[model samples]
Target: MFKAGRTAAPRTRPTSMKIAMIIAGTVIFLLLGLPLIVQIITAFRGPFLPFGVSSAQWGVTNFITLWELREDFWGVLGATGAFVGGSTVLSLLMAFGLAWITVRTDAPVRRLISVLVIVPYIIPPIVKAQAYLLMLSPESGVLNQLLRLLPFTGDVPIDPYSFGSLIFIQSLTNVTFPFLMMVPILTNMDGSLEESARVSGASWPKTLRRVTLPMLWPGLLGVTVLTFILGLGSLEVPLLFGQESGKNIFSLKLWTLISSSSGQLPQYGLAAAWGLVFLVITTIAFAVYLRATRNAERRASVSGKGFRPSTMRMGGWKIPSMILVTIFILLTAILPLLALLWGAITPYPVAFSFDAMLNRTSFAAFGTVLADPDFWVALGRTVVIAGGSATLAVVVATVFAYGIARSRKTPWVKAADLFASSSVAIPATIAGFAMFLTFMVLNPYIPLAGTLIALIIAYSYRVSIAYRSSYSATLQIRPELEEAALVSGASQLTGFRRVVGPLLMPTVMAVWIQMFILGTNEFTLPAFLAVPETRPLSMYIYAMINPRSAQLYAPDQGAAMALIFTLMVFAIGYGLQWLLARRAIGRARKAVAAPDLTPLSAAPGGGGEDPSATVTIAVAKRRARARVR
Candidate 1:
C-alpha cells in the first residue's frame, strides 16, 4: 500500500480534469481565436518581420493607422455591438413570454406551438431576409405597396433601411437562440417551487419577479453573453438588412477585406488587426460573464431551495391560450410559408401585385434556381459536410460524456466533460475564423484545410459541446446493466452493443439530427470557407441575394429554396424528437402504471388520483423549477 489512492495526491486528479477542460476550452478558443495568432505569427515569419526579431514589435503601428484610416471598421464594430444588445434583449423578452405560455398554462397543442416557434431560425436567415425583402422593400415589396395604397402615404418614405428595421430583422433571426437556450431550463424546473410561492400570498407578477427570475438567471446570463458575442461578431444580418442603413459591422468589414477587388495588397494586415481586437473584446466579455455567473451563484446558493416550480390551473384562460398560440404559429410558420407558396406559383412575368401572386412567372425562377448546377453542388456539399461532422461530434461527445459522467475516481475523465461543455458559450463565427487561421499556419500538409473537411472539422468542434451536454445527462443511466453484461462474459464491444449502445442510441440520434440542421444553417463559416469549387449552399444563397450576382434572388425562388431547406431540417429534427418522446413516454407510462408502487394520492385529503387523468398528466409533466431555486 505504497500509495492508497487518496495519498496518491487528489491534486493530480483535478489537475488532469482541469487539463482536459482547458484543452477543450483551448480548442474552442482556437476555433475563432487561433487565426489571429496564426496571422500575427505568419506576419512575423514574413521577410519583413512584424513587431521585431523577438516578436514584441508586432504592436500598435499597424493597429493605430488602420484604426485611424478605416471608418468602416469602427462603424461595423459599433453596429455589431448595438445590434447584439438590441436583438438579445428583444428576443429574450419574446422567448420569456412564449416560454410562459407553453410551460405555465395548459396551452392546447403546446408542443406543436413550441415546434413552430423554433421553425423561424431553422430557415436560413438568407432565405428569411429574402422573404422580408419581398414583403417590405420600399419600392416593390408587398408591405411598401400596401402602405402606398393607404390614403395617408403621400408624404411618407417607408424605408426598409432604417435602424429600427435592421434591429427588428436581427431580432427575428436571433429570437430562436433564446428560445432554444431556455427550453432545457424551463422543462427541468420543478413546478412545486412556483406553487409554493403562489400559495403564500405571492401575486402572479410578484411570484414571477421574486421567485422565477432568480432561478432563470444562469440561462439569462449564458444566453445573453452568447447573444452579445454573436451580435458583436456577426456580419450577416447587417450585410443583408442593415446595408442600406449604413450599418457596416465587423463581420461585413472582414468580408470586404477578404472579398473586395482592391487592385493590390488588400488589407490582410489590417483585417488581422481587427480580428485580434475583436478576439480581445470577446474574451473580455466572456471573462465578465463568467465572473458575473460565479458571483450570482454565490448569492443564490444561500437561498437556493426557497422556491419550487408549481403549476397554476388556468380556469378560463386555456382556450384563449390555444387561440393565441395558433395565431403565433400562423404568423411565424404559416404566413411566410404562404408567401413562399404564392410566390412560387406565379409564373413567367413577375408582377408586384396581389394579382401577380397568381401570375405564372414566379414558377420559372424556382425552376431556374433549382436547375442551376451550383444549387446541386452546394446542397450536396452541405449534406456531406453536416452529416460527417455531426456524426464525429456525436461520437466524441459520447465517449467524453460517458467517461466524465460515469467516472468513479478518474480526474482526466471529468476534465473532458468540463472542456466539452465550455465551448457552448463561444460564438460560432469566432470559432470558424479561428479554424481558418489555424489551418493556414500549421498542418497545412493535411488535405482537410479549406476543403469540405475543414468545414466539417470546424462544425464538429463547435458542436461537440452541445452533444456533450445532452449525452452527459443521458450517460447517468445505470452502468450496472453494462457491468452485469461484462460479468456474464460478454465481450467489451458486445456489452456495449447489447447494453450501453442500445440505451444511448435514441439520444445519440437526436443529437445527430439536431447538429445536422444547425450545421446547414452555419452561413458565416461557409462564407469564409467558400472557394469557387467547393462553396456551400449557404454561401450560394448569399451570392444569389447579392446585387452583383447573376443567381436569382427573386422572392419566389428564394422563398421556395428556403422553405425546402427548412422543411428538410424540420423533418430530421422532429423525427428524432418524436422517437425520444415515444421512448420516454412509454417508460413514463409504465412507471406510472406500476401496480405495486402506489404514488401519493393527489386528491383532496390524500386519496389516490388516477395516473392517466389530464390533471395528473399535466402535473406530472410540468417542468420543474428546482434549477431556478
Candidate 2:
C-alpha cells in the first residue's frame, strides 16, 4: 500500500475540469501575455496609424528607423544603463546593509528601522520626485538653501538633476524591497558555522565575507536580477531628472515616441523596436534569476536540528551603525515627507523656508484641494479603478495560480503560468504602449480607448504579483484537504469552496491589499490610458505639477493633494495589513488549540503508523544524539 497521507496520483482529470483550465489559461494569456506579442508583431510591421495598421507592410522598416535614430537611441541607452545599474547596485547594497544591521547585529531601534525602510516602497515615485525637486532643486531647493549658508560651501552645492541624485533617490525608493527579501534569509541562517569560523580565528568581517555571503549568493543574485530589470522600466526618476541632466533613458524616449510633438506622428514602429530590446534584456535577466533560484534548496542553511541565527556584537561600532541607519531613515522616509508637508502649507510657487512655514503657513491649500469638485471626482475614480482592478486581478490570479498548483504538468497550465508571471518583466511603459495599441485596434468594435474600462484593464496588470503569492500559498497546503472533501461526496468546485477557499483567504486578502495599493499609486499605466474624464488621482496630481500644463501648474496644490493621497493610502494599506496580521495570528492560535484531527494514519491508503509517530521517532533520535554529544 502507498504511504499514509499520500493519495494516488490521478492519471486523468475530468473533461469539465480540463475545459475550465483551458478557459482560465486562455483568459490569463489574453489579458497578460497578448500585449507583449502585439508589440513584437508591431515592431516588424509598418507604422501604427491612429486607426490601425491597415496600410502597413511587414519588413525591417522599424529596425531601419531604429538604426537611423541610433545616435539618440545610444545616448538614451547609455543613460539608462547608468541609471538602472547604479540604482540596482546601490539599492542592493543599502538593503543588504540594513538587513544585516537589523537582523544580525545589536542595532538600535531595529524594529523601527524595519518599519521605516518599507515606507518608501508605498510612496509614489511621482510624489518622491516632486518632493526632491523642492528639496534639492540647486537654487530654490531646501537642502541647497541650507547648504549655501555654510561658511565653506560653494554657490551651488547640490544638483538634483544629476545622475548621482537620480540614482540615490531611486535606490532609496526601492531599497526596502531587497531589504524585506533579505531579512528572512539573514534571520534563518544557522549560527554554528559562524561560531566555528570565529573559533578557527576568522574575524567577523572575514566570516561574513567568506561564509555568510557565499551562502547568500543565490538570494542576492535573484534580487540583483529583479531589481535591475525593474530599474530598466522606471519612468519617474529618469523622466524628471534624466533629460534635465542630458541623460535621457529608454522609458522617457519611448514616451516621446508615442506622444511626439504636435506636428509629428507617433513613431510606433521604433517604439516597438525599443520595447523589444527591453523585453530581450528582461528575458535574459529572468532566465538568470530562474537558474540561480533552481538550486536554492542546496543553499538552504536551516536544518531540523537546533538552528541558531548568528548575531554580531557591536561593541564600538554600534553608535556608528545607528547613525548610518538613522541617515538612511531620514533619506528614505523623513526628508521627502517633510519637504512635501512644507510645500503643501507654503504659498504657491513653493519655497522651503522655516520663516514662511511659521509665519505664512496656511491651511488654505488643503482646503482649496479638498473643496475642489474635480478632486472629489478624481478621488472617486481612483478608489473605484484601483479597487476594481485589484479585485479582478486577484480573482483571475487565484484561479490561474490554483490551476497551476493542481496541474503543474499540463501544457496549457505551464504556458499560462509563464505568460502570467512574465508580465513582471514587462515594464509599465511598454505595457502601457501595448495596451494603447490594443485598445486602438479594438476601438471600432469596443470603443474602450480613453475609458474607465481601459484603465481597469491596464491596471489589472498586477496579476503577476497576486499569482506568485497565491501560487506559493497553494503549494504549501496539502492536497489531502481537498481529497478528503471529495471523499465525502463534495464536487471539485465544492471542495475548493468549502475547504481550500478558507485556507487561502488570508493570502488572497494580503495580495489584494498589496495590489490595491500599487494600482492606486501606479502612474505609468494610467498616464497612457486615462483621459480628462477618467483621470485617477495620480493622473490629476501629475497634471497639477506638470510644468507643461501651464493652466494647471500648481506645485503647492499638487503637494497638498499628494500629501492627503499618501496619508489615505498609508492608513488604508497599514490598517488592512494590521487586520490581516491579527487574523493570521487568530487562525494560527486556533490551529494550535484545536485537536489534531488531520487524517495522518486513517487516510484511505493508510495501512501502517501515523505521520505523528514518525515525528516522535525523529524527536527521540535527536534527543539521543544530543545526549551523546
Best by TM-score: 2
What residue pairs clash in candidate 2, if any at all? Answer: none
* Tens-digit per-residue lDDT, 1-629, candidate 2: 86789787979757554566567667677777777777887888867743465688888888887788778778877888888888899999999989988898887788988988888877877887777777786666767777898988898887777778888878877787788889987888888888999999999889889988888888888788878877776777776776666346778888878885446888887888888888888888888788778888887889988888867888999988888888888777787888887778777644566676678888788999999899999989988998999998888787768778997478866766777787777778888888887787778898999998888888887689988998999998777666666666666666665667777899899999988898878888877778889999988998888888889888789999989888888898999999999999998798555444342224332357676655434333332333223
Q: What is the lDDT of residue 87 in candidate 2?
A: 87
TM-score against native, each model: 0.75, 0.90
Per-residue lDDT of candidate 1, residues 1-629 (tens digit): 57555544446345343345345445444543455566665333432223322533444565666668777666766776776778778778877767877776666677877878977877766667666655565554555565677897863346667877777667766777788778777765666767778889899889788878877777678777887776665556667766556345667666666555545445545666666677677777777777778765433422356545445677787877667667556545565565565555554224365565444343566677778777788889988988988886776566545545555656765555544565554555555655665665454355566688788877786655555655565556655555556556564445544556656776787778778887887777777666767777777766655766654544455556666766766776677688778988897798577553444344333256554453443333221111111
Cα deviation in Å at residue 101, candidate 2? 0.4
Summing lDDT over every window of 10 consecutive residues in candidate 1, give the lowest-scoring window: 620-629
lDDT of model 1, residue 34: 51
What's the CA error at residue 157 for candidate 2, in Å?
1.2
**Global lDDT of each candidate:** 0.63, 0.79
